[model samples]
Structure formats: structure tokens, C-alpha cells
Target: MTNNMKHIQFNNVSYEQWKEEAIKALKGKPFETLFTPTTDGITLEPLYTQQTVIEKLGDQLEKQISTIRSLKATKDFSSAQQIFGETAEQFFKNIEDSLERGNQILTIDSRVLFDWDETNISRLASILENNPFKLVLQDKNDVILTVFEQIEPSSRKQVSGYILSKEPIKIDNYPNVRTISANTLPYHYEGANVVQELALSLALAAKFANNENNFAEFVNKFYVNFAVDTQFFSEIAKLRAFKILWKAFTKAYNAESNIAVPIVAETSLRSFSKLDEYVNLLRAGNEALSALIGGADVFTVHPHDVLVKPTDKSIRIARNVILVLKEESHAASVLDPSGGSYFIECLTAEYVEKAWSLFLEIEDAGGIDAYEESGKLQRILEEVTTARLKSIEARKHSLIGTNIYANPEDDFNVETNPLFVDVKRLSTPFEELRLLYKNLQPKISILTYGKLKNFKPRADFVSGYFATAGIVANQSGEIDSIADLLNWINKTDSQYIVFVATDEDTKTILPSILENKRKELIIDVAGRFKEEEKEWVEKGLNGFVFAGQNLVEKLNAIAERLKGEQQ
Candidate 1:
């Protein structure tokens, strides 16, 4: 369409030439520093060029990018979600409103035992007469299935849901109902990584696919559920990989090509933070965005405060996240918004390959049920879970408003146990530390001495670090005199005093401030002075807190000290 641009001439830079330029730009830093490796053993390069794509995927590079799809444009791309209520009447009303508010597929959690006198079931059956729906039969004993059984065979044609077990459920009468489901949430909540999650899903699908009686219809009737998190590119690649891997799994069964399985993506409760609850909004939004872009048939964004204190507004915001992404962002209109990108394409391939390997391993171990029963699945999940927790504590991974950039004055007034499911959360440790702060209101005084340049930066750092642990930081403006600083500390009645001045200023004023200090008050320095640390500790210095410090460990030690003092 545009020939004028083709006439433009420029020297094509070789990969080695570009690398030389990049190394020069890096100055003294090692070129290897640009690579980041994920737990799946995929090393990410700083830049992905055409040469890199060709080298990695070979002749498939061009075909891969063009074929990479986040989602297929199927059935007008309506946003689907599950609605739960206390009563059948209330749930009936919710269904009506949820559909009106742009929710295309409305799923009912099958645990709720409705007023099964046929009145409520009749009403739901009447609605299913026209619109499509899903029943989440997470538990085999969920009494709602009784009402479902009552539905006429014709009305059941439009309904779909999982049997929620390894063993297949086949109703002799309602043959149209989908009983086989790829249940991935159990492993997801147990902190399975992206690869493990995908592999587990595939393993479960293969189990159903291996069913001799239902082998032919399993791929068509099967539904997959997954927990989506806020790891932007990884989550996007995860969803896309699911489709790719699923197709490959089905291909072995001689199923139709490009058969897109119905995928339900729910935002991860483990990703929600209780400290700065507002930040959960961002986490949910990112998780929801990843699912929508990755091509999930149905998406559920859990309320930001769902783990602790979910309000009506929070629930509304959670549901509306999908709406906004679909309508406002117009993300639903694109088939694969993240496709064709060198980074995403490469990552997707890596994930698919790794996940396929794990699936094969699971298959070797006699499928998911046998592997899970062997306790190896639990051990592997625990390993990944531990690694993820360590990453958060070490600040290698960041959780805004929980582990980093916390708002000191934020209030966490929710009950210890909310009237909702007690989901496993990654922020539990940080939340416990903040709870101590809320209860004790421990005061930390910053003794800012020397010039503004010497102490201001460290003072701010100290203040923010304590805020993350919900500790109150009372920082005095630059006080050059040791007596003045001690006087301010006495007035504030701080139990912890941190010197925010320079190393030189701290060394000069150390003896004077240490003299006749409060016996119970813990003293600390803002920076590491290894040579002087032992001597300072001998002279009653508590510890050092600075950049790159293990803040969770440091704060936990402080909290323990405070607790002992209180006792």
C-alpha cells in the first residue's frame, strides 16, 4: 500500500554489530547482566531481533507470529462470569441484572441449595430456555445439581459446567450436559507456577481424553478453569500457551484443528494484598487484562478486598473490571493484541514447550490423580510457593503498597476473618506485621543530623521502609546538636531511634548520643558500616537498615523485639 517508504535506504546492522554497540553503551557492566532467567529456566534477552527469532524458532518464526492468537473472535466475544448469592430469589435477580450489565455468560456456583420446590428451579429453567449458562459444581455434593437434574432435556442443551472430579460424570438422560472439566484451581491456589499450572491442566484433560467411552466427545465438551495473576507478560503468554498446548493435546486424539476450548480465568486471590487494599485494584485489573488479552472465554476479577473485607463497591469494581476492559479499552475486539511481539511470541513458545514436558512427566507418573496421590505434586508446589515467597521478601519481586511503596497512614480495619472464603494469600506475612503495628502503634524516631543533603534522603528512606511494616516514623528536621536530638526523642517517646545522618556524622556523634540513652530504646543506623558495625553493636546498636536489606526479616526482628518489650 505504501511504496514511498520502501525507497528509503539504511545500512542494516548485524546482530554482532548491535551487541558491540550495546556493550559500549553498558560501559563497564557485563553484557550478561541484561539477561533475566525465570524459574522455568528460560533466559530472557534484553532485545529480540529478527535474527534471534529466526535462530530460536527457525523457519517457523514467521508462521508462528502470524498464527499467535490471544483469543479467537467467537460469538461476539461477550464477557462471562459467575454470580453467587445467599438465596435463589436473590440469585435470580442477580442473573437478570448481571446479564443486563453486559455479562454475556452468567455462571452459578452449584453449591447453593435453592428452594428446590421447583419454583426457583422453574424460574432458572425458564431463563435457560433462551440464554446460555454454566453451573460450577466444584463439589460433588452440591445440591444445586438436583435442581439441574429437574431441568428438561431440551433446556439442558444450552447449559455447561464441570463435574469437578477426576472420574467422569455422565447423566444418561442429560447427554448434552458437559460433566468433564479441566479443574486447575486447586493447583493454582496451592501456588503452582505458570508451567505447572498449564501442565496440570493438560494432564487432567488427557485423563478425560483417555476415557475410552468419551474419547471422541471429550475435547468438544471439556471446559478448563484457571487462576489468572498480575504477572503481565507471563500471564498473557500463559493463556495463549494453554490454547496452543490444548490444541496439540487434542491433535494426538485426531480432534478438529483450531478447536478453541472454553477457558474460565479467575483473578488470583493469592495476588491480593491486605495492607494497602487499594493496590489490590491494580492487581485485579492487571490480572483481568491478562486474561482478556490472552483469549479466555470467561473472566472473573475477584474483589480487591475479597480476601479480607469485601464491600458492595469492591465487588462492583471487580465485576466492572471486565466490562471496562471489553468496552473502554476495546481489548476484546482484537483477536490477539499481544501476538506478533517478539518477546511474547518467544515466551509463549518457551511456556508451551516447558508445559508440554511437564505434562509428559505427569503422564509418565500415571496422570494427575496418581501423581497427586504420590505427594510429589504437593512437594513440587511447595517448592515453587517457597521460591515465590522468598522473591517477595527479598524484593526481587515487588507488590505495590504491601512490600514496597507503602502508604504509612493507610488503615486496615477489616475483621481478622471476613465472611468469605479464607483464601491463601502471599501478603499474609506482611499483613501480620502490619497488624502488629496497628495494635502496638510503635513509634520510630529519625534523628536527622548534619546538612539536609546528608540526612534527608536516608530519613525519607527510613520513614518509607517502616511505613511498609505499618510502623509510625516521627522524623525531626535536621538537628545538628546531639542534645537537641535526644530532647526531641524524649518528647516523642520513641522506642526506636534511627540515625539518618551520613557515616561521618554518625561516627562523630555516636558516643554523645549513646551516652545515657533510654535502656529500652533500640538504636539503629541507616547505612551499613561493616568495619564499625561490631563495635557499634557492642555499644548497643540494634541493627542497620538500608537499600537491598532483607526488609521482611529486619522488620520481623524488630516486631519480635517490640513484642518481648510489651510482654
Candidate 2:
């Protein structure tokens, strides 16, 4: 009885049957509305199946599967957490704590070496003698090279890792250490879409290989670092696609096609917000897991408060995120955990095709160097950034705790990094709006009209919209006529008043309210009155706050009015 198994059967549904059922469930909604288009120009279907994969891959289905399956021989990866401290002793203590906890790679910024004394240098050298490490030497190579020379020869021989630098350095003594990187975090920060990040990274590596005397050696030593965002499945596909692209890239160069290019993935800070800092933990965790599942050789989960001042607790939590995913989830036990999924396989193939095409374009434009000099890449990034920010403002793109579902009571007075001041983060505009009016305590009132059922919805909408910018708005009692509305406005000391009522009531009541309202009081309407907006503005209405309106522009205008009042 224990060994025997009972057989169970269920009705098999075809794609058409499933579509019919889905349509019935949608309750008259259009089926086409379920389709989503990403910033990279890839349209995502609501459902994917084996047939869908065949349709997408066509003749290359088997080839794509084989390429992705061979991307990683083993699923294991090193946990590399970038350590930061003000002094050498603090840095060493942090390094020790990280290593003792679960950090496998001694990740360091070369800029820190400039402050290290002989004692700390020796301590770091001793750590390198026994452990693997990665040093990021962005424009600090000459000094760091001399610092490396100070390490004992025996220690250098035992060291194993890679160095992330734009300019290659010859460290022949350290045989296991590689000194070239194709880092795409910069592009990610500048708001490049997934395809751009992938293509730029390849173009960057190709640039390094072109400059090197030994192409094969450069390919062998080269590694890539990508910023894994919270796009979940798309991010996983992006990394897998890179592996296929790497193989194709090497084959094009006649180099060894099977060599696995090491990939280091870190959580992107593009979506990190300061208002509700705790939510950043969830964002980081989502990104970290995606990085691991996507087959990163080394992964880093940046502290949730990294954009601001990261505390020791935050850093420890970041380190443990990787530890928990790798240890408890047992994700590393199987090679290519996301392999063979119909949707992901299709996505990987699309990414490979698009990224390779963009790479060829970069090459044709004289590689990354000439492309950068031409400013074409910068202009493209700017356009993408503007579009993304517009999406966020329109509430089409959600960044919980920042642009949507924001916490008005949350404080944002914490210390921030001056260096990250210029990074074009998605939440920065909303955060700035919050910061501008947080201490000002601007008074905003929603002038309710008509029945509670009609006015309540618009009143709540106006309140929540203002709350996103950290301005709490008080709602007035129901008003039946123009006299009651004018009486309420006279008693209240609000600087900004919004008319909240149904479309019909708003059309009838707003013109009268604007005509009678004081000249100093800035007025706005909750519902869209686009056809009569010009007439209303001329009658003394400031603007309109509707569902699809840009919250940034609306909030900025309010902030400017507040600033003018203070002056």
C-alpha cells in the first residue's frame, strides 16, 4: 500500500480553450489589453506555452536551448559584498565581519587603498593570500598598482580573483588574477533599458579586446558586471542571454568559444527610495534572487539604504540576503534552475537577437569610444530617461512607496551620499517634492460638493495624490450651494483649495467657486475638465489634478508657489 501510487487524471485544455476561459473571466474586458510592452520594444503575452516557445524560436529553438543549457556548468557562485568604512581599521573590521558571516569574495574599492597605511596593507595582503577578492580600480590604477607591488611575492601567487578597471594593468606575477572588466552599472544608473545595458557591455569588452595586444588573453581575463533590477523574469533572461551572446561574440573573433565569461550581478539602485526606506529591502531581495537565478558568477546585494547612509545592520541584512537565497533556497544545487522554461527561453532568445544587433551597431559606429564621443549614446539615454520618468509620473509605472502607495508620514531627513546626488533615480523627483514641502507644512483643502458618494471618491483621490508629495490635505464637509462653499472657504486658512465633486457638479460649481475665491488662494479641480480648462484658468483656476496627470509637474508647481510665498 505504501509503495503503490494512485493515478489521477484531469481534462487537458488547448490554447484556444484557455483563451476562451480567460476571456470569460475578464468580464467583457478586451483580451488585447492583457498584452504588455516593455521599454526594450518586446511585447509580453499574457500566457506562454510550449507552442508559444516554438512559435518564438522557430528553427533556432533547439539551438537556443542547447546554448542556454551549456551557459553554466555549475550553479555555484561567490557572495561578494562591497565593504565601506571611513577609516582603514573600520574597513578591516567590516571585512572581517563580512567574511565571518558569509562573504566569499573580499570586494574592495581601490580608492580606499590611498588611505591605508603599511599595517592595513599587510593585513589586506594576508587576507588576499588565503581568499579570493575583486578590486574596483576606476581611474586609481597607478597608485593601486604600486600598492599591489608592496604585497609579498608569495602572497601575490596565492591570490585569486579579478580587477574591475577600464585600463588594463599587467600583473603577471599574480597568475590567477584578471585585470579587465565590462561594467554596465553606469549605463543602468543612467536609465538604459535592458537591451542597451547588454549591448553596451559587449561593446565595452570588445573595445578592451581591440586595444589589447593579445585578443585571446583579453577574452580569457575579461569579466562582466551587470546591475540586476527588479524586473524579475526579464532580468533573469537578460543574464542568460548574455551567456549566449558571449559565445557568439567569441566565435566571431575566432577565440575559444567555450570559455565562460565571469558575470558579477549587483542590485541596481535605480528604484531605491528614501521616503519609505524599509521597502528598499524588499526591492533589493527581489533583485538579488533574480541575479542568483539568472546565473551570476558572483552576486552583491547592496544595502537597502545604500543611496543614503547605510548602517551596519543594513549591510549585514544585504549580505544575508545572498546567504539565505543560496543556502536555504538551495538554488545553487542545480545548474540553470530557470533553464527550459518556455517563457524565459523565448525571452532569452529575443534578448540575444536584440543585444547582438545593438552590439553590431556600436561596432559599426567605431565601437564604444567613438559612440561616446559622438554623444549619440548620451542622447539616447536622455530620451529613455525622460520617457521612464514620464511613465512614473503618469502612474503607469509603479515604484511602491515612492510614486505609488507612498507614505506621507514617513520621514526623509536621513543623510544621503553627495556622490549619488547626480544619479538619475526614478524616485528622486518624488523624493525632492517630499523634501521641499515636508517641513513647510503647506495647508491644502479639498472643497467637497454634491453627495458623499460622488464627492468622497474625488476627495480621497485628491488627498492621496497630495500625500504622495508629502502634503496632507483636509477635506471639507458636504456643501449644497455656492454660499456654503464660499462660507467654508472663508473660514478655512488653506493656501491651496481643490474642487472635488462629480463631473456634472464640478462643471456647475467650479466656475462660481473660482469667481468668488480670493486672488491669493491657488485653486485646482480634482476631475479632468480639459475642454473648459482654459476658461477655468482665466477665471482663476490654477490647474487640474486628474488620474493620468503628471504628479511631478503638478507637485513642482505647488512647491514653486510655496517657495514664492516664503520669499
Candidate 3:
């Protein structure tokens, strides 16, 4: 058993014991109630168990399944290997019971996704086959994605039908499946980015069509996303831009290949009012409407005041708002709700063109992997993100419940009638402290993106990194501007690991640096590196993000944080 496994033996504590003693130790632990983190965030469990899978789907399973299936026929049949009819029958009952018992948001943890001894995909399938849970396959290393071959034709047909089925009801692929989820949570939390999300998606979808072998299948598949954020129009514009870009991207590929790109909208975690908890619902509802009007396929806004432990009342009202939009207000059945306004189309198209251009720029830069390693992609994102942060800090761009209309009195301290925060919780204003300082320090970033053969870039990119970080840089080799920064980056303090980027940054440096240095080094890419330059960057690095983000901003943030420490 793993060391972590040795410690956790679950014997359910009585309410008072869990409340007053056991759960007390967990009060200050950091975890998002819902929505996965896009980058740097905690991964602690609110609770843990050896029996990872909940065997029974609780009480009201039958009714919920009947209701959902009655309303929507299942789509992606091949994907949902729910072979047991009785098990399938059991899932709906669990859903209704969980909902009735106040089990609002669902969970499928890492065990089913990643296990040391077993292949993740099959394991996930087993879990999935047993229970219909909403699982987010965000990590690139997810086990389910074992194959590198292009998606086949049969898969494409299944996916296309799946897309069409989701507009009104659920389909065959785990009729309960939320195939696409918006991952805006992490981007907003860490560096606060959006454009790359649109651009990279454009590139990947295109590459899936043009480059991959399974063009007959995977190319035809259209997946939607569920985004959770508090940005109103910015959120709306994001959805609008996605639709616009998909059209352009598809046009760039084979015509009439739309297949349908849908979006599932959620409220941003960064926007929750720590003060005015109630305003969160309003903000989320607005964001949802924007996504809805912007033509998203599915919409699930989070409960307001989720930053605090949510109450049953809060969840009820959050669902009610959607009900209002769907049933009472009649927002659900609308088509192309924002289709014709010149401002929206023009504005959305502008973002579309910008994203496409960015996509092309990535294509121009030699795809995803090449753009990332050269520090090209990270540098660009850094340039834009830095300006954004400056705007936010300067109050030029406003966050409704956050920076603007300040609420200082503990008036925002919400009621805890079954919704109180963990009394013994950790506290450091996420805005005020470096989350990593409690763990390790960070340094200037040089990303090795996409995939690389070796550890070559570390010696080259940091060539002049010292001077850039205001430290005198000295290198063992030539200090030309081309590879000096990369070499210099390698010289930074090791324990506090230098902040090299993730996607493009990981591999882009391999060939050049490896060849130049003549070193038998290894570049650690995620799995496989795309050979085509333009397509590589768009799909591989996803708009050139590295070090979990852009390089320069990472450098500046680390520098600023370090400088603050010295002060």
C-alpha cells in the first residue's frame, strides 16, 4: 500500500465527532468545491477512502435515470460501455437520490483516471461502466488517451451524433456524460488568460481534421466545453469567439465540417465575492446567460458563495435560476440567440480573426512544439498577460465583486446554517501570498513545450537569463543572444526549481540546444511530440503556454515575489 494509503482507514464518525474533532483538522485545507484547476492549485481531498468507488448509487437512482433518459436519448454508444442493463438502471436512481440528498455536484477521482499499476483508460472505463459519473479528463497525461493514432471513422459518426443529441437531451455515451467541460477555472485563477483558450482550441480541432489519420472519425467529432468563471461579457465574448473561430477553423480545413462546437458555461471561481456572497449567484447567472445567448449547448452555473462552504439553500437557488431561464423564463429553447447583431457578430468575428491569426502565427512558427521550446509562445503570452495584470491592478479593468465596489465590513460573512466554513482552516489571502512559498520558490521561466528528445534547452535558453533577472549571468559556453537566455536559465538556483514552461517550452529547445551543445541530453515532453511545426504549436502547446503559462510573466512574478521577500 502507498504511504498515504496506510494512514486512511475509514470508519464513519458520528456527526458530532466529525464536526467538532475530525473535520476540524481539515477546516483550513485548500480545495475547490467544483471545477478543476487549470494550473497551480491545491489537490487535497475534503475526505479520502480506500473504497474509492461508491458501490451503491444511493436511494432515488431509478427515478432520476428514468427522468433523464425519458427526456434525452443517449448519444455516443461506443464510448459508453455500460454493458449491464441492471447497472444502467441503477444509475438514474442514484442520481435522483444524490440530488434529493443534496449531493449536487458529482465527482470521479484520480483512481479511476490514473493508477500506478493499471492502464488508466480501462480502469476509468470500469468505473464508468459501473457508475455514470461526470469525469473531467483535463490532464494531458490522462490514461484514457492512450492511443496517439488518429480517431477512426466510426468514432467520428458516433461523436457527430453525440453532438447533435446533446442540444436537447442526453445521448448514448453515459446518457449522464458531460463530455466537454470548460476549464476556465485554472486560467482565471493563475494568470487570468482567455485568448489562448480560444486560439489553441481552434488549432487542435483543425489539426484533428487535417493532420490525424483518423480523419474519418476523430475529425468529425465535435466536443463542447463547460467553463466556470465570473467574467460577464468577457465570458460571453469568449463563447461568442469560440463559435466564430470554429467556423473559420473548419473553413480553413474541409468545408461543411462544422459538426457543431458547443459550450457549457459555468461561473468563474476568481469572481466569487468573499464579501457579498449573494452577488455571486447574480454574477454566475449573468455569465451563464452570456454563454447561453452566445450559443453554448449546455449551461450549468455554480452556486453563489461557493468560496464558502455552500448551503442547501444556496444550491437550491442556483438551480432555480437555471430553471427560471429554462422553464419560467424560456431561455433554454432559443436558437442562435445572439446570431445577428452586428456588434456581437463583428466583435465575435474580430476575436475569431485574432484567434485564427494567432493560430496561423503558431502554424507559421512551426506548429506547437517548435513555438514552445524557442520560448516564443511563452514570451508572447507573457507580454499580453503582464499588460492584463497591470490593468487589473491599476483598476483600469474591473472585477465586479472583487476590486470595484468594495465590501469591507464582515457584512459579506455569510450565514452558516449548515454552511459554515471550516473553523480551523488555513488562511492567506490568495491575492496576497505566493502559494508556492509554502512549498518552494520559483524562478525565471524557459519552457520546453510540446515534446522534446532531450534536456537540451536548459543549457541554451538561460545564456543571458541572469542579466534579465538583474543578476550577472556567466555561462560555460558562447553567450550569443540566440541561446544565451536558455543557458542562463539553467544556472538559476536549483532547489527552488527554475520556472520552465509546460507545453511548447518543454520541447522547442531540444533539437537546437542539443545540436548546438552536442550533449546527449533528454528533453522531457508530455508523451509524444508533433513533427509538423504549425500544427504542433496550435494543438500541442495550446497557444504557446509554457511553465503552466508564459515565460516572462513567470519570471516577473517570481522576481517580484522574491524581491518582496528581500524587502
Candidate 4:
């Protein structure tokens, strides 16, 4: 083989050319509608070019690119999976098993410390002496921190790990352990957008640093944790932006700007649902990849059933997601995989700029602590949470097995952790609705009229819509006349009946069926009849089910009606 490469020449298309083609493909839909606005107040364009990147970064484009590219010294990340067990022995066994299967860090939850005996503490100390660990402390109580005291000073010196806690911890001999954590997971769980998360995390770090007399020591022992969601490129950009923001933040304090801040990223549970739990696996995979490409120092994958009791299989699968990405895909072999892409670079820049501004705002408000104390943070979180829940309720945002495309037959009998009761998850409303319908066991029927072609689509829509709430609607055989519809409705025990047919057929037959049908049956129509809505209501139509309507609201009304009938 010669020391040469084959090259193929192709026509270089301008951004305008691409835009023109995209416009043509849009087929008269307003091209501006392609612009998507994120909750972070950033508008996402459909396409990004080198010119766009240049415009965003201005004179600092090359510097920004270089900074991001150099942010990670290595792409390798430790798999820091939490070991869950009800008892100390089981927890140790799980830790051993997880380590053997490629879990690099011994992740311990503080709650598990309550079950530890002297022997278990000894065993933990032994493990810590030889391995890296991550301890998640819910508070600064001495009881949980006492676990470190039991370890011999010599052994403790060999221990290397980080603690996830809001307060700073000082272990007598653990020199390699990082104590303070600036975590964005809480805000993320409360529905904070990417910019808010980044800014809040920085504000948290600033608070920690300001409280300490030694800024350098605080910087050395401080690490940040992020709950990576499934927004793929945006999430990758968010992480990258944090590094740039951290550099700027450190420079303001005259600290070393090049110092690397350790990032521990885990897949977010905000989008996880208990209904179609398996879909959570795909979500975790996507988030894990984002964390990998975005240069996290430690990555954790919460098991698909983490909301409930996680089985051994689910935990193993979660661990193997990282293993597969590393060993099979060789993603760890390259640093900054998203470094040069125009879109990612621009996005990273945008995040850095916006997040820095927000961080400054938070700092002016006396940091994260003062902001939280003032209740402003809680109010902001509430607003964002409401907006996000509304999106999920309206079906504007889709959670595969929770809000849209739900499995009506899926059983949700498993007990959930009480700890997650306060977690603001996107799927909670739909899950509650499903559970309500499952308990009610309402008898619903889809009363179809007209030919199969005309009625089947509407019938299917009504059935699927009800199925989302876990109500299986019985579809009646074709009814050609109003008398037949009335006979079926009267004979059946269904408390709710939905009329499904062509608009004209429904208009022709609905009046007669409503006039003759039993008074107790709550009748609704499948399609929207805007002009005739008031007329239909007066004629005894309960409601209408159509695309883009708020499914949660509609289902809640039906559920309320079911409750009223039961009473």
C-alpha cells in the first residue's frame, strides 16, 4: 500500500441552499415554526452552519473550541453504581458482585449505614482500603460520617473517593477524599431547565467556597454532580458548558483556571415511568452516552425499576449499559467526541454564556443558599414544574409508556419507595390516573355507527385514548341504525359510551340515540365538532376526545363522572 489517500470531490452546498431545500420540503408550513424554544430560554434553529458557530462565538470561536476539546484529559469514566440492600450483609455482597462486574466505584447510600454492624463496617473499611468509593450522605450527622472513623488511619489514607453532600465533611485521615458536592440533581428533579441547573450548581459551589477560608482546598475537594436527561446533544452541551463556567468561576477567585472539576453524572429519573419500565432502559442508555461524550469523571445508571424495587437483573443490565458502551463501542478511546460539530459547539457556547449570566444573577442574590431561603428558588421551580407537567398532560411531550402510547394492560402493583414520593416526575399524573382507572374498573363502550372505514378510525382513537388511562373500552359491533345503538347501550352495563363515526353519520344518528338512550350513560364523541359543540352538549354529549386535547384533563373529568355514578 502506498502512503497516499483517495479523495472524492463533491459540490459544497451553502447554508442558504440547504435552507431553501428544507423550506421546499416543509410544503408551505411556516419555516419559522421549525425554530424550537427550550425551557432555558434558548431558541434552537433547525440547522447550524460554521457561520452560525462563528457568529455565536465571535472572536473567541477558536478559543472556545480549543477549551472544550481540552476540557477532558481522558474519556475514561468510572461506573459508580449504587449498591442497594436491606441489610449490611446483602449490601456487601452486592458491592462485591457489582465490583466484579465492572463497577469501578463503591457507591454507598447513607441510609444503608443504619444497618451496618461492626463486622460490616470492618468489611467496608477493608473494601475502601483497596478501592475507590462514592458515599452519598443525606445530612451532616456524625452517625453516617462515623463509618470513616472506624477505619484504621493507615487504611483511610489509601482510600480515594468523593462524597455527595451539601455540607463539607472533614475525615481525619482521608486525604484523597473530596467532601463537598455541588449537585444539580435536586434542581433537575424539581424540573429545572439546563441553564438553571448549570447556574444553580455553580452558585452552590460558590457558596461552599465562600464559607471556607481556604478557596484552593475547597476547590480541590469540591465536585459537581449532574442528572443527565435524554436530550442527547443538549445534555452533552450542558456538561461541556459547566466545565467552561467552572474555569471562569475559578478565575474570578484568582484560582487556577486549568484545574479540572470532577463531574459525576447519572441518568435522570425525572423522565422514568413505572408503567412501561423497560423503556427506562433505553432512556438510561441515551443519557449514559451523553455523559460519556460530555466528559463526566464518574457515570452512574439508575436501574430501570429504581422507582420501585430494582431486581438483580435490572441492576446488572444498568451496569452493563456502561460496560457495553465502553468495551463494545470503544467510546472511551476518544476524547471530546462532540468537539468540532458546529451544532454542539454553538450549543455549548450558548449554554456557557446564558448559564454564566444566570450564575452571576444567583451570586448577586447571595448565592444558592440565600436564593433558596428567599423562596424565590422554590417559586421558580414550581413554575417550571407546572409548565413541564402541563406539557406531559397535553401530550406535547411524550413519555412512551406513561402519557402517550401507554400499555393499558401493564400492571403497576409493585410497591414504590417512600423516598421518591416528593420527586417531581413527568409521568406521575398519568400514572396516578391509570391507577385510579384501574381501581375504578369502569365499563366503557365505543358505540360505532356507519361503514367500517368511516367508523373504525374513530373507534380505534376512542379505544386507544381510554386505554391510556388503563380503561379498556368494549367496542360494539357495527350499528346501522339509531334503534340498534339504543338497544346496545340499554342492554350493556357500560356507564360510559363514546360515539364513533363519520361526522355526517354522527350528526344524523346522535340526536336520535341521545334522545332514546338511558339517562345514566355518560356519552362522549371521538372527534371534535367545534360549531356544533354547544348544540351537542345541549343534546346530551358529555365531551369530545380528539388529538392535541389535554388527555389528563379529559381523563380526570371521566374519572370524576365515574366516581359520581358510583356514589
Best by TM-score: 4
TM-score, model 1 to reference: 0.90
Worst 10 residues of 3 by lDDT: 76-85
lDDT of 2 by residue, 1-567 (tens): 464445656787889999999999999999998899988879998989989988888888777767766767335777989888877878888998989998999778766533666677667777777888888775744455565666788667777887876667677677778788888878889889889999998999888888888777786678898988889999999999998898888887886557677888788889888878889999999998887888888987888888877789999999999899988888777677888898899899888889999999989999998998999899888888888889999888989988878878877755666545666788888888887787677888888988888778778878888889887788887788889998898878998888888888888888888887787888888878779989998998888889988999988888788777666
What number of clashing residue pairs does each candidate have, in the order they appear? Answer: 0, 0, 71, 0
**Model 1 lDDT tens row, 404-451:** 888877777556433235566787888777877788777678878978
RMSD of each: 3.4, 2.6, 25.0, 2.7
Residue 91 lDDT in candidate 2? 86
User: Per-model C-alpha lDDT, please?
Assistant: 0.76, 0.83, 0.42, 0.84
Candidate rank order under lDDT: 4, 2, 1, 3
Per-residue lDDT of candidate 3, residues 1-567 (tens digit): 457876779887753564456445557653244222221111222332222112222232333223222221112111111111123334434344445543323332222211423343434343334333344343545443332123343343222222212122223332223333334333334343456667666544554445445443443334544454544444555676675565555565565544444354455544454544566777777766675555555455556755555554665566566556655545445444544443344344445556677778877877765666788766765665556555544334544434334332223343432211332111113222222332333333333322233323543334232222233222233333335645654444421222233335444553454344312121222323446435534332222212223333444455454555445
Give me the runs in candidate 2 sitting further than 4 Å from their true place.
1-8, 24-29, 140-142, 418-422, 480-482, 565-567
- Candidate 1: where are CA atoms >4 Å away? 1-27, 62-76, 111-119, 160-168, 172-176, 256-258, 308-312, 416-420, 486-492
TM-score of each: 0.90, 0.94, 0.46, 0.95
lDDT by residue (tens digit), candidate 4, 365-479: 9878888899989888888888878878888788887777778888784477655656778888888888888889898988898778778877877777877888778989677
